[model samples]
Target chain A: GAGVSQSPSNKVTEKGKDVELRCDPISGHTALYWYRQSLGQGLEFLIYFQGNSAPDKSGLPSDRFSAERTGGSVSTLTIQRTQQEDSAVYLCASSLAQLAGGNEQYFGPGTRLTVT
Target chain B: AQSVTQLDSQVPVFEEAPVELRCNYSSSVSVYLFWYVQYPNQGLQLLLKYLSGSTLVESINGFEAEFNKSQTSFHLRKPSVHISDTAEYFCAVTRNAGGTSYGKLTFGQGTILTVHP
Candidate 1:
């Protein structure tokens, strides 16, 4: 089975420009996650979506960061008016569900976003 | 709220020698523990996990972690290491019971394991 996949392995954009990173979770995966890895923060959880709607979005750093999942598979993370600080590797992961006992997330090769 | 504490930010060891990466989490409740390895320029990969049944879990690559409830720790250990083991290792935990939390992974600062030959 194919693991999670992300688009535009590397993205370089001007500051203040909006960028959208896409993620394709494994087929039949019911849950998707978006995370950011920065030099300062290490690895931070951005959001989690079950099917379509996100349940916990507290990890989103600011209003400029937003994400959505559609058709219960593909998820896009949008960064509006990207700042220099927004330059980081945006990672996506998926799993069957967020269950406690036996569910493990499968990660995708992160999309490295560089705001120039 | 839950948090992960990886005491050592880096661990350098000689090839073919034993190694241990310490990880401690705040919560003692029923939780899922995992160790992830991030190779250079690659996504984080699941090294191993300790969910239930066994206090000791082992990865096919000779990596193992013991779930110590009394210590609130899940330290990853490998009796022997190779240069290929050079990468960032993350310790994560989630407070999930009966399918909850959306499998949100709270990772530590990460430990850079450098195996020098």
Candidate 2:
């Protein structure tokens, strides 16, 4: 089975421009997650979606960041007016579901976003 | 809230040598611990985890981690490592608050493991 996949392996954008990163979860995966890997912050959870429930947007750093999962399989993270701080690798992951203890998450190669 | 600390930012060792990457976490609530490794030009992969019962867990690749409740640590260790073990290692934790927290992982500042031939 194919692991998770992300689009535009690398993206260089001008500051203040908008960029959209896409993620395709594994087939039949019910839980999806977005995380940001930055040199200063390490890895931080950005957002999560599970089935038809409301997406958890708590980890989103600012209003400029938002994500949506459509039809329970694909997700898109949008950053409006990107800043230099937003330059990092955005990783996507998926799991079967949130089990009692925890579920192993399969990660994608990630899209490296560089804001100039 | 939970926080993780990976004591060593980088570790360099010769092939077939023993190595240890220390990780400590703080949380008021019970949590699950995990070790993830990212090879160069690759995505993160689960190395191992400790959820309950046993305090020690091992990965197929000879890496092992011990969950020390009193010490609040989940340090990863390898008796003998291969050059292929070179990669960035992350220790993460999530609250055991069941489905409410959605298993949001709080990661440590990763440790870059460099194995020299």
Candidate 3:
């Protein structure tokens, strides 16, 4: 089975420009998450989507960051008016389901965004 | 809020030597623990997890972690390591929340393990 996949492995854009990163979760995965990894921040959760319920945007650092999951499969994370501080590796993960204890998350290669 | 702390930032060991990476977490409620490994230029992979039942969990690749509730720790250990074991290890935690969980993981500052031949 194919693991989670992300498009545009690398993206470089101007500081004020907007960028969208895409993610394709594994088949049958009902939960998807987005995280950011940077040299200073380590790894930080950005957002999560489960089934059709409203997405968990609690982890979004600021209002400029947003994400949407269409048809419960593919997810897109959009950053508006990106800043140099937003330059980081964006990783996508998916799990079979969100259980009480925990569910293993499969990760993608990640899209490295560089805000110039 | 939950937070994870990995004591060591880097561990350099000779091949075939025992290794231990310490991890401690702080949370007001029960949580699930996990160890993730990332080889250079690759995505993170699940190494092992401690959800429930046994306090000790083992991975297929000779790695094991023991969940210590009292100590609030889940440290990874291996009797012997190989050169291929060199990678960055991250310890993460998510709240149990009793029922259907939608919590995000709180990851530690990764520990880089460099196995020397």
Best by DockQ: 2
Cα miss at A86, model 3 (Å)? 0.4
Q: Mark the regions of model 1 whose C-alpha exceeds 4 Å error after superposition.
A: none
Expressed as tens digits, the lDDT of each residue in B1-117 for candidate 2 is: 899999999999999999999999999999999999999999999999998999999999999999999999999999998999999999999888776868788999999999999
Candidate 1, residues A1-116, lDDT tens digits: the string is: 78899998999999999999999999998988898999999899999898999988989999998999889989999999999999999999998866653588899999999999
Report the C-alpha lDDT of model 3 over B20-87, residue by residue, as the tens digit: 99999999999999999999999999999998999999999999999999999999999999999999
Candidate 1: interface RMSD equals 1.8
The reply for model 3, stretches above 4 Å from the true place, is none
Better of 1 and 3 by lDDT: 3
| TM-score of each prediction | 0.96, 0.98, 0.97
lDDT over C-alpha atoms for residue A25 of model 1: 97
Worst 10 residues of 1 chain A by lDDT: A95-104
Question: lDDT of model 3 at residue B39?
Answer: 99
Residue A50 displacement (Å), model 1: 0.6
Whole-model lDDT values for every prediction: 0.91, 0.94, 0.93
Show where candidate 2 strays beyond 4 Å.
Answer: none
How much of the true contact map at the interface does candidate 2 reproduce, as a fraction? 0.63
